[model samples]
Structures are given as C-alpha cells and as structure tokens.
Target: MSVAKKLASQTAVYGVSSIVGRVLTYLLVPIYTGAFAAAEYGVVTGLYAYVSFLNVVFTYGMETTYFRFANRLGTDRRELYDRVLSLLLVSTAGLTALLMLLARPLLGLLEIPPGHEQYAVWVALILGLDALTAIPFARLRLENKARKFATIKLVGIVANVALNLFFIVLCPAVASGKWLPALQPLVTHLYDPTVGVGYVFLSNLFASALTLLLLWRELLDFRFRLNLAVLRPLLGYAYPLMLMGLAGMVNETLDRILLPKWLPDNFYPGQSSLTAVGIYGACYKLSIFMSLVIQAFRYAAEPFFFAQSTEKNSPATFAMILKWFTLCCAIIFVGISLNVEDFGQLFLRRPEYLQGLVVVPILLLANLFLGVYYNLSVWFKLTDRTYYGTYIGAGGAVLTIVLNFLLIPLLGYLGCAIATLACYFTMAILCWRLGERHFPVPYPALRLGLWLLLASGLVGLGWWVQLDGWWARHAWHAGLTVAFLVALYVVERPRTAAPLVVR
Candidate 1:
C-alpha cells in the first residue's frame, strides 16, 4: 500500500479508540460540573495540570528515544527496549515512592489544602502509572501493533467510563431509590455524596490501575538490560526532546497552572482563584475534539514519517501531507466554532459554567493551530534537526508564560485562550522557517492560507446570523458546515477527479 494509504488506515484505527475515548471522557465533564462546585472542579483541574508536567519529567522523552533507536538498522531492538524499559521502571518507581514519602511537603508546595493532600498523592500515583505505561504504548507503535494498541486503549477508556457512570450517576440514583432499592446501603456507602471534586482524581487512579493490569503483556515483555553503549547516544538524542517535551507541556498547560495565581485578589469577590481555574478547565474540555484529532494523527504520523524519511520524494510527500492536514483541521475548526453553543451545553450542565462558553471557540482554534504545527514539525524530526524544535518550543513556552501573566489578570480565561493561539502560531511559524532552511518542503502555503481564510469567513457569516434557539442554531450551523464542504468540493473537485477520469 502507498505510505499515505497506510497512514490513513492507521489513523482511522487509532482514531476509533481516541475519538470514542475522548467522547466517553466528555461524559465526565457533565458529571463533574453537575456534582461539584466550580471551585471544587478547579482543584481537580490544578491537580491534573501538575500531573501533565510531572508526566513529562517521569517519562523524560523515552518514548521518542525508543522510536529513534528502534528504527536504526544496526541497533539490537531487544537490548534497546530492555534498557529503555528498565530505565523507565526505575525512574518512575523511585519518583512515585519519593513523592509518597514527601507527600505532605509536596502538597504544601502545590498549595493543596491540608484536607486535600490525599488528592495530591492520588494524582502522583496516577502520573507514575501513566509514565510507566508510556513505554509500552510506544512499543505498540514501534512494532506496528495498532490493533492491540487500539484495543488496550479502548478497553481502558470503556472501563473508565463505566466506573464513572457507576460512581457518579448509577450509584447515586440507586442510593436514592430511583434505580435499585435493594442495593441502597452499598451504593450510598461506596458513593460519598460530599466527596465532590476528589472523585475525579479517584476515578482516574482507579482507571489507571485497571489499565496497568490490561498492559500486562507489554510490561512483562521487557528484558532488563542496561546497555551503556546504546544508552549514551540515545540519551544525547533524547535530552533535547525532553527539553522540547517539557517546554511543550508548559506551553500547553501553564495557563491552567498560572491562571489561578495571576488572578487579581478581588476578581471574583467571594470565590477563589481556583474557582476561576476550574471554570476554564471544564470549558477547555470542549476543545478535546481538536486534541483527539491531533493525538490520533501523531500516533500514526510519527512512525510513518520516520519510515518514509528515506524515500526519494519524502519531502514533497510531507509537504503535501501537511497541506492536507491543515485544510482538514481548518474545516473542523469552522465546524466546531460555528456550533460551540450547542456543544458547550453537553458539558456545562449547570448555569454557572455557561459563562465559560465564550472561550471555547478560542481554545478550539488554538488546538487547530497546534495540530497544524504538529504536521509541519515532521520536517525537523526527519532531518535530525531536532534542536530547532527545542528552540521553537522554548520560545513558545516563554510566550505562553508571558501572555498568561499579562492577560489572565486582565481578561481571565479569554486571555489564556488568546495566549494559547499566539503560542502555537509562533511555534508553527518558527518550525516552518527553520525547516525550510534545513530541508525545504514545498508546502502549498498560499492554497492552505486561502482555505483557512474561506473557512473563517464562512464561520463568521454563520456567527452573524442569529439563529434564535437551540434547534435553529443547530440547523444554521449544519447548513454552514455544508456550505464549507461545498466550497471545498468546488475548489478541489477538478484536481481530485481529473486523474481518475484520465485513468
């Protein structure tokens, strides 16, 4: 099969689980918003933000390291795997244990309330589990075991969704004599009514534990060998990747972490900064569709791109792939932006969260830029010019931090959204500039820009037409989406069909 076809197949397979899993995860947003106060949800948000940062630390870019060494013609795959897996096990286990030992001090440093230290501990454990699982997941990609990878991922997501339903919905309803009267006491005891935001972390920890059990095959396949000779070069390649990953994480998540701190003392009268953070975090979930696409593409694209790097026309192929990727993502951006009001209602179960709906389009577009950046970034990775990535990512991280600091205090969550867009845009442009110098790919820059411009205009037109109510808004957005589709078809149909007609 052609490389493009292979990638498309892999992306579809990965997307089945990723897209479904994210949709399932979206169910929890409503549950949390309904069951907990916004401030309480903020605690969940802050803790998870910390987990994102810690995950980068614990994994230390070993997943990419595995990919790099595994692809080398002369490397001993088993030894490389063993060495990497052994390093991960030792590092993550030690980190988890150390955190457990210093839980109290760590909690204090994170500004966790005295009563919420256990939440911090649970988050640390979850992060540790996730870090350990990263290597196995990477191995799945390395070996082209997409079926097993998707199955394991889907199972975990299903298990998580089931557990969430049991705890948050079914358990409560059963306890209240709405579902199962006989199991009331058991349900009530198991489902703490006052736990509120803590259950979000607890559900995640339980899910992680279950996922670890499901990864038994990949975990046991490891053969512990510390090959220092292989390790030396792998570490050199991976160190900058680690820096890039850290900076990327900061760019992606620092707004969640810093927004609370950057909030003015009296911004919300009686409510705390954490409260504001929770609202932003919950609203951010609306953009997970963009994240889902980016993730699925990454899963398939990394190995595919690396494998194709030696092909004669790989650079041209990459440029074409990136152009297509941006066009697709821009279309999705318009679709989502046009219908965010209805989509926001899916997760914002309570009235208070409706305020955050304003930021959804901004966050969605930011993620779209992020996806485009990822597609453009293969140039650096394939050319072994990874230092450019580190440079661009570090620059973006600085912008993220500065923007959040300046804007979060003044504009609240909207500022964070704008900052995210600016950060990703800067990274994409910087990477493209550096990449053109190192390995010029003739990306259809003008055509891609025009597509985005057209989509933006369509969405803008849709926004201006006041579709009176929910159903009307839905109809209008659907029509607008169709309009975008028709426009794309009109522009590309001749090129797409000419070859087929000739054949």
Candidate 2:
C-alpha cells in the first residue's frame, strides 16, 4: 500500500471508533441538559476540564516517548514497553495517592460544592486508571493493532453511555415510579437521585476501570524495573512533551476552567458564572466533530510519521496529508457553522444552551486550526526537537490566558471563542514557519490559505443571509456547503504532475 493509503486505512479504523463512540457519548448532552440545571452541568464541565489537565500530568508524555523509542532501529520493543509501563505505574500510584490524600483541600481550591467530596476521589481513580492504560493503548497503535484499539475504545464508550443512560434516565424514571415501577426497589439500591450530575463522573470512572480491566493482559507482560539507560533518554524527551501537553491543555480547556472563576457575577444578567459555563460547555460539544477528526488523525499520524521519518518522500507525504486534512476540516467547519442552529436545537434540549451557539463556529474554526497545528507539529517530533513544541504550546497558552482574562469581562464566552481561534491559528503559523527552517515540507500554503478564505466567506455568508422561512434558510446554507466541496474538487483535481518536495 502507498503511505497515504496506509495512513488513511489506519485513520479510517480509528476515526470510525472515535466518531461512533464520541457521537454515542455526545448523545448524552440532551439527557444532561434536560435533567440537570446549567449550574449542575457546570460542575460536570468544570471537573472534566481538570481531568484533561491532570491526565497530561499523570501520564507525563510516556505514551509518545514509548512510540518514539520503540520504533528506533535496534531497540528492544518489549523491554521498552515494560520499562515504560513500570515507570507509569509507579508515578501514577504516587500521584493518585497524593490526589486522594489532598482531596479535601483540592476540592476547596477548585471551589467545589461542600457535599461532593467523593468527586475528588472518583476523579483521581479515573485519572490513574486512564494513565495506567495509556501505554498499552499506545503500544497497540505502534503495532498497528488499530482494530484492537478501536474495539477497546468502543467498549469503553459503550459502557460509559450505557451507564449514563441508566443513572441519568432509567433510574430517575424507576425512582419516580413513572417508567418502571417494578424496578424501583432495585434502582433505589443503586441510584441516589441526590447524586445528580455525579453520575457523569461515576459513569466515566466505571468506563475507565472497565477499560483497565480489558487491558489486563497487556499489562501482564510488564515487569516493574526501570533501566536508567531507557529512563534517562525517555525522561529527557518526555518531560518537554509533558510540558507541551500541559500548555496545550491550557489552550484547549483552560477557558472552561477559568470562565467560571474569572467572569463577574451577573455578567450575563441573572446567569451565574457557573450557568454561563454550563451553557458554553454544552455548546462547546458542537465542535466535537472537528476534535473527533483531529483525534483520530493524531492516533494514526503520530506513529506513522515517526515510523516513516527515514523515508525519502516522507516530507511530501506529510505535506500532502496536511493539505487534504485542512481541506476536510474546512469543509466540516463550513458545514457545521452553517447549520449551528439546527445542531443546537437537536442536541441541546434546553433553550438556554442556544445562547452559546454563537461561539460554536468560532470554536469549530479554532479546532480546525488546531488539527492543522497537529499535522505541522510532526517536524519537531520527528527531529527530536520536542522542546520546540513546548515553547510553541506555552506561547499559545499564554495568549489563551491573557486573551480570556481580557475578553471575558467584555464579551463573555465569545471572548474565549475568539482567544481560542487566535491561539491555535498563531500556533499553526508559528509551527509552519519554524518547520520550514529545520524540517522543511513543501506544504501547499497558498492553496490551503485560499481554501480557508473561501470557507470563511461561506460561513460569513451563511450568517449574513437571513431568510424568512427555516426551510429556505437551510436549503440556501446546504447549497453553499455543497458549493464549497464542488469548488475544492474542481481546483484540486488530479493531474499528471510531479509531487512537490522541499529539497
């Protein structure tokens, strides 16, 4: 198979799982919004944002390090696997224990509600389990076990979704004697209505635990010994990645975390900061289509890039990948941004969440840029200049923080949406500029820029053109979306020409 074909096949498998699984989980938005108040859902949003941040800390970049070293010419892949797992096991244990021990203080620091002390412990366990399983999953990717990876991911997502429905929907009906009066006694034993939004965390914890259980055989091959020969280079490489991951999380998720704390009371006139957070968080799910694609591509691309680093045509392959990736993202950006209202109405059961729909397109565009940045970041990873990722990510994080702080007071979450777009767009540009100097790829800069410009114009047109009837509005927007794809196909039609290369 050609390199592109191989990557595409791998991405297809991963993307199917990611898209299917996330869409399944994404379906719970209506359950959450319908059953809980915005303030209640805000807790779910806030807690998971911390999980994203701590997940980086708990794993500390070993997954990527494992992939990098394992693919080296003469490395003992099994030994590397054991050593990496051992390292993660030890560190994860200590960190999880520390988190458990300091749960009360951490809760206070996070400004969590008084009675939800159990949330801290549940979150710590979830984090630790996820961290422990990180290497096993990474190993599967390195070995091209995409099917197994997808299976495990789907299983976990299914379990999570099932649990969510049970706790959030089924149990409530049973307890209320509305749907299944016969199950009331059994449901009461299992479900506490007061737990409320806590079920979201509980569902995740159970899913992570189940995933770890499924990966037990992968862990059985491990022996708890850390060789400094491996440890030195791995840590040397990984610490910077960890830093980059942390900063990247800041750019990605810190807005959700800070939006509640930083925004003034009554900023939205009768809406609390937490309520604003809930609404923004729910609307933010509207952008998951972009994140889903980026994540699936990252799964296939990272290991593929490293393994192909020595190939003569790898730069061309990388450039081709970015061009097509950005085009796909641009299409998605326009398609969803144009239909943001429909998505909001369909997914967000409550009307309050519709208020934050304004941020969805901005966020979709932001995530599209983020995917481009991921493709551009291969240069640093391939060249073993991972520290450059740290610098770029840290710069983006600073920009995100400063922008969020400055704009939250003025424009609320729209400011956050703006900051996210600016941060990721800047990072993508910076990565491209730096990559040209060190590991040049003949990226189709002009073509990709023009496509994005056209996509943006369509989105603007969708916004500006108001229709009296809903069907007319949608028909017009759908036609515009189709025109985007048709135009790209015409412009990018295949030709008998040599592929562009940097050298």
Candidate 2: lDDT of 325? 93
Candidate 2 on 7-55: residue-level lDDT in tens?
9999999998999999999999999999998988988888888889999
For each candidate in turn, the TM-score is 0.94, 0.98
Give the C-alpha miss distance for residue 401 in model 1, angstroms: 0.9
**How do the residues 1-503 of candidate 1 rate in per-residue lDDT, one tens digit apiece?**
97778888999999988999898988888988898888888877887787787888898878877887688789887777789988888888899987777777766654667876777678789888888888888988988999889988988888877887788788778977999899987876788866656676788888888888888998888888766785788778777888898899898888988887788987867768877888899889999988999999999999888888889989767876776677788788888889887777877888778888778777877887788888888877766667878898899999999998899888988899999989998888788777778888777776777777788788778877887887887888898899888987887777642212110
Regions of candidate 2 where Cα sits further than 4 Å from its true position: 495-503
Model 1: CA > 4 A from native = 109-111, 464-476, 497-503
Q: Where does candidate 2 have its weakest 10-residue lDDT segment?
A: 494-503
CA RMSD, predictions in order? 2.8, 1.4
